[model samples]
Target chain A: MPLPAKAFQRWLHGIAPDTSMADVCRLSQVKRTTLAQQLVRGKVAEATVVSISRAFNVSPVTSLAYFEVYRDLAGPLVPPTRQELVSQIATVDLLRAVIARTAPEEGGGGAEESTARPAESWELSPVPHATSVKNWVDAIDDGELRHRVSAATGIAPQNYSAQLTANRLAPEVAIATSRAAGVGLAGGLVATGLITEAEAGWAAGARRAALDGLSDGELTALAGDRLQTLGKALRRQEHDQEQTEKIWENLG
Target chain B: MIEILQWTTLVACAAATLSRIPNLVRKKNRSLFYIFALMTVATLLSIKAPYLAIDGMLGNTNVANLLLRFIIFGAIYFLGMRIAKGFGDVHGLQFIRGRAGTVVLGLISLALLILFALMDSEGSSVGMMDVYAKDERNRLLVEYYGAAGRAYPAYVCLAILPAMLRAAGSTLPAMLRISALLLAVGGIAITLSLLFPVIPPALGYLTFIINYTAILCFVFGLMLIWLAKAMARRKVPEHIRKPAGT
Candidate 1:
């Protein structure tokens, strides 16, 4: 059987127990009357949807999915399948992960990388096993994890905790946490069955394309040891190619 | 009406000076502190109080003119340096701060002063206020000084203003965005005043007014920036305040 048509409403209530419908309207900067009417008619404006999502500390995609379910209920009233719900939620999670990685801190500083182990040394580290999001959350110190997630995603600490307890991973938060903990995104997401290998490959390619777009000056301006590692690697590759060419000439 | 405008300009200069003191005391930004200090001195020199006494001491050889011009040049140079620093151009800052750069700037100021003195006829004492009423030679000297004064700051503004505006347009803090906007307006105003001198006899009375308005705009714009920094400092918690050079 398909999930109930009221699944979106139920999810909203579960995640944001302290937040009222009026509070959501107020925080979203929309009129309470307008929102009420929209909810009644099973229709929400796009901008209003974004505001409501932000107000409840939920991802915009997830909020839109919830609203879509409501909008669809006004028609044939066929509930969403389990797989469909999972896909919608997983997309929201992934978006949140990307946002957490990219968002600048209060002073316009980039998100701080973990100082415990350098990113370049990850190859030498032991490979981590894929864990379910709920199990991962349970294993870690909840307070520190919440703070990191909040810093990354701009989601409230309470909402972050509630989402984790409910066995949902805001993709950005999950990806960022996994990255910091030295578990790769693909490993975590694949283990959870949240993303297929094809989707993971596409994501990796997109990231590479984005990095390739940066100008030489911008690449140089990037702070930390990442630049040093990249410079060393480039030089080593050049040196190896030169040695190989000399050997080929000697053979000829 | 002229007297009122003169007094208003003086008031603005005084306000700009007072507004800068807190930032100077905090020592938050060295370039900004120097910009305000030089501006205050420039305003005082403009009114012919200290310069009149100095000129008399020097046998009215117009040495005070050289001194005043040097201070104005210093103000413009510092303003350029501050903008360069804001744009995160470390090399630009190094160029301005280097010994070689300082020597070049000093030489340029000396050359300009000598050229102005040579251009002016013997014993001519045409105040900046009376530039329009003066003869062609004195008017040319004033025009040269105006052009030279505006050139450095204008170049700096042209190079960095777009970058600053882009930064401001992004998701930066509100105070930073406002400060960038104020600085742009001030830079544009200074450029305009230089480009359009009060040359026509009918508008001769406006020479001092226009100059002072430009000065006020530049100083007030910097003052707003100082205010923004002060606000940011207050927002930072006391416990996190680190010692200097840490």
Candidate 2:
């Protein structure tokens, strides 16, 4: 939902008490004219809010909660499921761990300790597509959960599949899936990289704890599966690019 | 029936042209403005009443027909160049800009002018076929001239049809995809009409339907693209449009 002008102004004042509008625009990486237009319209856009939140190093969900529209989604949440926790690991981090497992130790390797230990906080970045929507859905799916969520949300199977492939879940679909799985309602949002775990009330190091808790065999299998999917995705992208190139070559 | 179809298509073309008046006034995409304006005028001149009036002013020697031909040529040339570049089709752009394409267009235009000059020009008519039907020599020249007029557009359309069809089925925005589909179908219809002589004579009525529908579809397709772009400039995403008063 659009943030109200007054609420936005209040949030801006709180975030940067002495900062000028030009500074705000620069910090948010939003154009001055665009910000002015939104202010004049009496509602700021959601992306602008996210940009401002990122600029100030605050969780987007927490920033959004300052507006009345997102207040309910910001605060505390129930503990996340094991699947939800694992889903929070950034894709590159997961891949890095997999690669690190095989790499020769520099001096008297601590490979065993490395495999058993939790990830460092810096390695747990939450970029979009870190875990695809499909993976998150699958993580929560206890066989019948997907069918139940589909029925409850009234999202067609094909449409759901398309959304999964696109790596996006509509907010409603995300909420419904989380509800069906009986996990924290914010799990879907967190897993999808739409909101941070801090804002969702997940304890610090929870994701690392879950990753460390996994058996070496489970971790290897998961990494292998992800790598296979990544390979297939890269191939598909190559094919599409080739097709586009051919069209340009022959027709342009 | 043909007259009704022609009028309907003409009106659609005019509407498409008029829809871009705001863009023209704002000095946005002036090339597109000229292209649509030229196309609209060409469509208007295709009508009997306007053609007769304009032709009368031009000495009633069928100079208006030649003017209409040249306007259509200019419009199509600009359109082909713009669309090829817009689609980022380097090959299509190169072909149109390269010597081969330029020579083909030049030859066709020259052939059309020479054929028109050779034909009987005592009276004005909407079509060369209609006025020169009685003059055996002029009839042949008119046919060649018409064929020459159709050649360049068909060639360009053939080159762009594949890209347009692919775009129609792509993941582009809904309006753009629809526009691509309409434009592709219009291009196909136009190509078919241009090749009508090779088709069975019994399908003459089909040709008329395709011809008029193609004009309407092509113009409306361009209009939709313009409308979509204009709307996109001002549009706030659905999630961002909550009531401000609240």
lDDT winner among the candidates?
2
Which ten contiguous residues of candidate 1 chain B have the minimum total lDDT? B237-246
Model 1 per-residue lDDT at B229: 47
Q: Tell me which residue pairs clash in candidate 1.
A: A93-A171, A94-A171, A96-A172, A97-A171, A97-A172
List TM-scores for all candidates, in order: 0.45, 0.58
The local distance difference test score of model 2 is 0.73
Regions more than 4 Å wrong, model 1: A1-252, B1-13, B19-31, B47-62, B94-107, B119-134, B197-214, B236-246
Clashing pairs in 2: A252-B89, A252-B91, A252-B92, A252-B93
What TM value does the first chain of each candidate achieve? Answer: 0.26, 0.68
What stretches of model 2 exceed 4 Å from their correct place? Answer: A1-133, A136-163, A167-210, A213-252, B199-202, B236-246
User: Model 2, DockQ value?
Assistant: 0.05
DockQ of 1: 0.00
* Candidate 2 lDDT by residue in tens digits, A150-239: 899788877887788777886546767887888877777765666667766788878777776776688778877776776676676566
